[model samples]
Target: MIRGVGSYLPEKVLTNAELAKLVDTSDEWIQQRVGIKERHIAAEGEFTSDLAVAAARKAMAAAGVTADDIDLIIVATTTPDYTFPSAATLVQMKLGMHHGMAFDLQAVCSGFVYAVATADSYLKNGLAKRALVIGAETFSRLLDWTDRGTCVLFGDGAGAVVMDMANDEELAAGRGLLSSALRSDGHHWEKLYVDGGPSTTGKTGFVRMQGAEVFRHAVGKITDVVYSALEQANYTVADLDWFVPHQANKRIIDGAGAKLGLPPEKVVTTVDLHANTSAASVPLALSVAVADGRIKPGDLVMIEAMGGGFTWGASLIRW
Candidate 1:
């Protein structure tokens, strides 16, 4: 069962107007193209793990579970404090958890859904009793500030959730994760990717994307995965109570929701507020909906995301 959710955005805000000063684009152009008004940027010394730990602490409190209760920790991100030690271990240490297994998963923006599915499998198989799944990113560090196309489209943030083994009664009640579908196509990786990596250049790289190509493929890919998940859960579009998609772009979100025939109000969007926080987007939107009392217990929620590497996935959850 998904026990609790939480999120954290850094204090600094970068407005589209401010971005115009750095690039040739204006606020009007950015808003028309990406629908982002502003985004949050992490402080100089604040790393991905710092944001992850802050979000994790809130999740633990909401779930009423202590650090000792978590037997597994999985953090999903492309940006790690170091390439050696997984970001999950860093979060584990900060949370004072020492007895559990911890690791990191990198699926770019589709990371949180991937992590959730992996964590669910471990819990179902009794590999762990409780798991902490976090989607955290310092994407601002990966942006080319001079390239307005990418820089204005990303931000930094973290979001997390606590999933515990549900009892038989809870399963009978349909009160946890229902089904998930994941897909990837490496051929289209160049459509969106980082320019450098440890193996390639031994340096953290900036974000690179073919915006038109990505936009062309996003709706179709997202709809396929979402429908696959819905089918696995024995559900249809009418059965969906909410659609929390990755906050990548307003155009993509609207396009996918429209293709699925979901009403505007049923879609949970934070792209305008946070831009694309990469892996952090979906969980951050989920946190907002939950905290606002829009997503209640017994509600059926659907989540989907597509990121660099052409990775895309969807998961069905019964809150």
Candidate 2:
């Protein structure tokens, strides 16, 4: 069960109008194309770990627990501060924890969903008593500012949740993660990916995407997992109280929702304010909806995401 959720966006905001000066684009063009109006950007010294720690603190507070209560930490991120220490370790240290295990999971935008599924497994197996799962990204550093297609589509932010074992009463009431379905097709990985890595160019390369190709695949892949997870939990589109999909593009999100037969009112959208935060998208939207009181206890919430590596997944949770 998820005890609490929280999210944090950087203070600096980059509006579409401001981006016009940097590239041959305008507010209307960006909105009409990607449905993004503004995005948060991290300052010069604000790293991904910093964003993760901040979000973690909020989630911990909301859960009414401290570092001593968490025995496991999992950060799902692509823009880690370094290749060695892992962002999870940095967060664990900042939270003053020395008795727990922490690590990172990379599934790009599908990260948070993957992290949640992973944490659920650990808890169910009794390997961990409580887990802090986070999805954080500094994608602004991965974009080619010159490429209007990618640069204006990402922002910096982090979102987290505190999950623990549910009591027998809560379990009987179905108040926890019900089921999840995850998938990846390496053949389509090139459609949306960064060109560099430690084993390759020795540099963090810019985001390179085949927009049309990705759009063609996104809807189908998204719906596949959505339906799979829903069915596994004995649920249907009508059973969901909230449908929170990845905040990559409005078109993809809409396409998936429509395919799932979900109404516009039931879907949560925050891309216009935060753009695409990759791994942070799902949990970010979850936090927003929770903070706004849109998602309440006993609500059937389904979260889904499709990311680079052509990775995609969905989780049906009972709130």
Candidate 3:
């Protein structure tokens, strides 16, 4: 099964108390509501590629594979070291990989799910034997520190999963990724987005979002996509061994779990510790769960996420 996972966070940790000095929010307000105590921030010299490479190395080590064992490398992120050369390519270089296809995928916070789905496809199609899928973000580069609402909700980190090819018949009979359901609506694009871009402002921009509006969509969309993936896999909510949703907000996670009739114990949450690493949230959460033995082999797992660009998706894996 495609289940080699790894994750990495920066060395620096920022506590809510530390954040209070920069914003008007109180540690009590943040912790009581969002369940976030601290988040890791990238050092000045660190980039998304750096975090990605660290995670990739760990995954490869855990899987007993090397860079040459990978036939594909997909790095998902909204914040890249540069607009070109792609953070994926940079990661490939750092891994000393030269033969694999490498590229980046952008779907904001849902990027990890998207990357996972894409990697699954490559393996299922026999186009790749092994693939490294990474979600890395240096969100500190995109924050409006003056805005307390969004500023306190993000951090920097990376997580990765290494997947290998398997026959579809074998997958259907219990092998790897069984099914994936994804969707996006451009109509809600402005609800959460950056103010600048290469073609637009010719500059990198800060994140701006309506927290309340995003909160409304997140609960509904995440729950729906999870069900959608289950349906595609011919399974039900009760079949899930674990619900590793995007670690965005505690309220959203709790609400979605309640709506799905899932007990709090089934939900794997790290938002309290990592805040919202955006694209890196789900994989980071997945890695944490896997590392802690919360998610075991042969488990039926479902992953879902929603983010800027209004992008979101879900995947069902037979781990």
- CA lDDT scores, all candidates in order: 0.94, 0.95, 0.91
Candidate 3 residue pairs in backbone clash: 298-319
RMSD of each: 0.7, 0.6, 1.3
Against the hidden reference, what TM-scores do the models get? 0.99, 0.99, 0.97
Q: Which residue pairs clash in candidate 2? A: none
lDDT of 3 at 267: 96
Cα deviation at 131, candidate 1, in Å, is 0.4
Model 2 misplacement above 4 A: none
- Tell me the tens digit of each residue's lDDT in model 1 across 122-171: 99998999999999999999999998778989999999999987788988
Top-scoring candidate (lDDT): 2
TM-score for predicted model 2 compared with the true structure: 0.99
> Candidate 3, after superposition: displacement of residue 10 in Å?
0.4
lDDT by residue for model 3 (1-319), tens: 5648899999999999999999999899998778899999999899999999999888888888989899899999999999998999999888887797999999999999999999888877888888999999999899999999889999999999888865667556685788888999989988899999999999898899988889889888898888888988789999999999998889989999999999999999999999999989998998999999998878999989999989999999988
Winner by lDDT between candidate 2 and candidate 1 = 2
